[model samples]
Target chain A: MIETEQLTRCYGSLTAVDSLTLRAEPGQVLGLLGPNGAGKSTAMRMIAGFLAPTSGTARVCGHDVRRNPVAAKKALGYLPEGAPSYGEMTVREFLSFIARVRSVGGDKGYRRFDEVISRLQLEEVLDQPIGMLSKGLRRRVGLAQAILHNPPVLMLDEPTDGLDPNQKHSVRMLIDAMARQRTILISTHLLEEVHALCNRVAIIANGRLLADATPAELERQSRYHGAVSFSAQGSGVSREMLARIPEVASVEVDPLDGRVTVFPREGKPILEEVQTLLRTQNLEVSEIQLERGRLDEVFRHITTSAHPGPAA
Target chain B: MSAVFAIVRRELLSYFVTPVAYVFMVIFLVLAGLLTFYAGDFYDRGLADLQPFFDIHPWLYLVLVPAISMPMWSEERSSGTIELLLSLPVTIAQAMIGKFVAAWLFIGFSLMLTFPIWITVNYLGDPDNGVIFAGYLGSWLMAGCFLAIGACMSAATRSQIVAFILTAAVCFLLLLAGQPQVLDFFQDALPAKMLGALAQLSITRHAAAIARGVLDLRDVTYFVASIVAWLAAGVALVDLKRTR
Candidate 1:
């Protein structure tokens, strides 16, 4: 539903977003992962038609952002960073104002307002001024306004930034439910959020797309060797002997406790051999398990290698 | 057009909901009344027309119009809500015109509240209601000129204080440019035609002519052109800043 061809934004001497080409299909939640100042917000703004890119183009629902901005913006809902709102307006008032501005008028407007209010559970504070609401509640109100028009595409920047864990879960569930029909592009620094919510993750750094794949694919790509961590009785299994075992690349032992972390090279099934060696040495094996690589490790490995870019 | 009206309605509702509109109206009414009656010495002059009342508009609007319009775009920019506004499907011109019309209407509303003064003058004597009506027209048009200036200044900065100060300073210069004291100072250095043109551009000269029950097309065009020029500048500034 959304596509960008070499989309870039430059401010004077600084290139905020550099030739980022990306696409999000219908019913897909594309998680845009990047650290601070990685052009995540700038990229989203370009797609939303708020900020024009210095070069290239961004299109939404087949409409060019710059050429047909109204049509392009009409197809997309954007929750900008910080989710700014008119503090003096009540929750209902703000949503109604946005609804009118978005041209969701007549019965559709009222229906959408009611639907979003209830969907985001903003009915309780609907009458209260938005300035008095907590940050989490205000963020939800921002979400309510963005989704009121039921646009085909949704670009949310840090949707769950300040929410508590439960609120985050509910919001995630909401986005996941909304993804059944709309194309959702979310930019967040939270790695676990991508693993939990998005099907396809795009890791960006230095204004470039470094890795774009499924969470499991990223983990697999980052693994060149596997490690097994186990605990045993403080007895005859010397660290030197464990390192000497066939297929075992290295063994790291804890000095205070009798725990050994064993790294085995690829194509090595050293678990069975290690079990046999423990049995032969008459050492009691307490526990043994394979360590699955995490997405955090993948994120760090990818972003650390990607040079830091200018602030967007 | 509907989008413009929606913004106008929202802006009007905001004014009523906040204390800004009430404070502005009360302050303007009281000041206009005091300046027109006591300060201008209306009874002592014994004029059947509203010339005394209309004469002070340029000075009144120098302060009052900015009080109402300084926050028009500055507050939006300060709160970061300009992003939300610009990102909407509305055109920048529509938004700019919408805000300008809203602030203009507000100043018009406050101007209308001076009806009691008109009633009081009519009750005391046979005042020329035609001149009074024309005077009101002139005052409203002049207020629009000041409001446009305020809108442009508001667009230039995020601080309302700065907007107000800059607008007031520019308007003060515009007002003073027509006075003999300032014109005489420039008389030796500038050509007579240039000095006359500078004074003609001042809102005071044209507004004074309109206040005298004369509906000069030249004065009407001055106010309209002033409003249009500043509003166009405002739209251009907003467009430039949006990209920034």
Candidate 2:
């Protein structure tokens, strides 16, 4: 479990992380969302015990971060931003060093070591220096080190930030596999990642919690929620006819793609009505999707509306 | 602590994994031998002792110890690994002590490789082995002082070159604190008592005193005190100036 109460950090007069309070249970994968410079990394650093908070407190597995950092850290595994490690050391050597530092030695330590290495699929690069590994491989190495000790709480700052699609998928699957057993907190600007991995999402802007809800709930806050958008073979769909539907609030034609979107009134279901309209009109509809909600729109709405924040 | 030991092992392995350890050892060994023979005139003195060898350590370490200690924290900061290392179940003090001890041991290892000199002296004449041991101990202690200072300077910045220059400048000042020319420059500006105390702070003075084949508690305490003070400051600086 991870719990932080009003955790704040200031560099000089500028506040990097403001009064922020959050919690993640064992079964939760809390996705911390924000735009660039939204203090996501800074908040993770505070919870991971790398940066001391200027005020408030954070606790990991019941250990206060400031009062008992070592104990707190013992229960937490943190993958810092950029996935930094000792680049000069081989992957095996680096993991072994982490094992030793974490006091994970002897038979049990070796077992756990092999388990993590194989889980992360790092056997092939075990002898290669971390510096020589590709960016995606290095990220996997970072993930391997974080999960080596199998701590109850894992805080990863942008775990799959720079990985290719396949790597991102594998990492997401790994997180999904681990989600039920540990409280994993990941910060990312990737909305798709938030949907794929996070059960609970917390959106921050200007160092304050703007919204905290399930991915679906945050999506519901998007203007696209309960809206039906379709692309016709040509401009055969009339905007006024769709807008005339009583449940429909507004009809919008995407200027870029010439797709027409029929928005519902107060998030009423409009997919059925839009389908009936399209069939009766004898319009050639190519594709259509009822957005659960557009997280990107919600994200922009929450972050950009707030003051422009500084990046750490 | 196991954490400290782990860090020390990693640091030592890192030193050897690159050419750094070999280069430092070769240079230290070559320089110590050359200075002892040419400057100390071992043949003219007709003494089997390694006194002249011990005398040259302060100057030797002044330029070289920074090489060992400069990367202690600077590299970590620059590469962004300070976050990983600090987030472990280790305190800043543990990390500081671990890195410091690792560098100290590396220097001690190089000093030990000078066993050929010890063996040659023993083979030639009856040198007081006890005094030679004491000299070696004192020289190691002095090197510890230099390493501690360099480690502290390394904590102050992310640039290794900056750390090197800063450590060298401070070590240089400390080395010359007891010199007659330096004292004369300050004699008119400071009180006689203060000047005496300033001389007492010179790392070379305590090192030279121990090189004379004596291990006074005062001299040992000076080295221990210097190490502790510098390391304490390093811990403080790491907390204060770490990259965000």
Task: Show model 2 residue runs off by greater than 4 Å.
Answer: A234-237, A306-312, B242-244
CA shift of B179, model 1, Å: 1.8
Lowest summed-lDDT stretch of 10 residues in model 1 chain B?
B235-244
Here, model 2's chain A TM-score works out at: 0.95
Candidate 1 at residue B63, lDDT? 83
Q: lDDT per residue, candidate 2, A179-293, as tens digits? A: 8889999999999999899998988876888888898888888899989999997643578888889999998887888988889999788899889988988888889898788
Runs in model 1 lying further than 4 Å from the true structure = A224-227, A230-248, A251-261, A267-289, A306-312
Please give the distance, in angstroms, between residue B85's alpha carbon in candidate 2 and its true position after superposition.
Answer: 0.3
In candidate 1, residue A111 scores what lDDT?
A: 81
Local accuracy of candidate 2 as per-residue lDDT tens digits, B1-244: 9999999999999999999999999999999999998997867789989888888888899899998899999999999999999899999999999999999999999999999999989999999999999999999999999999999999999999999999999999998998889999999999999999999999877978877878889999999999999999999999876333
lDDT tens string, model 1, A281-310?
A: 877778887765567877888889645432
Q: What DockQ results do all the predictions give, each relative to the true complex? A: 0.69, 0.69
- In model 2 chain B, the worst 10-residue window by lDDT is B235-244
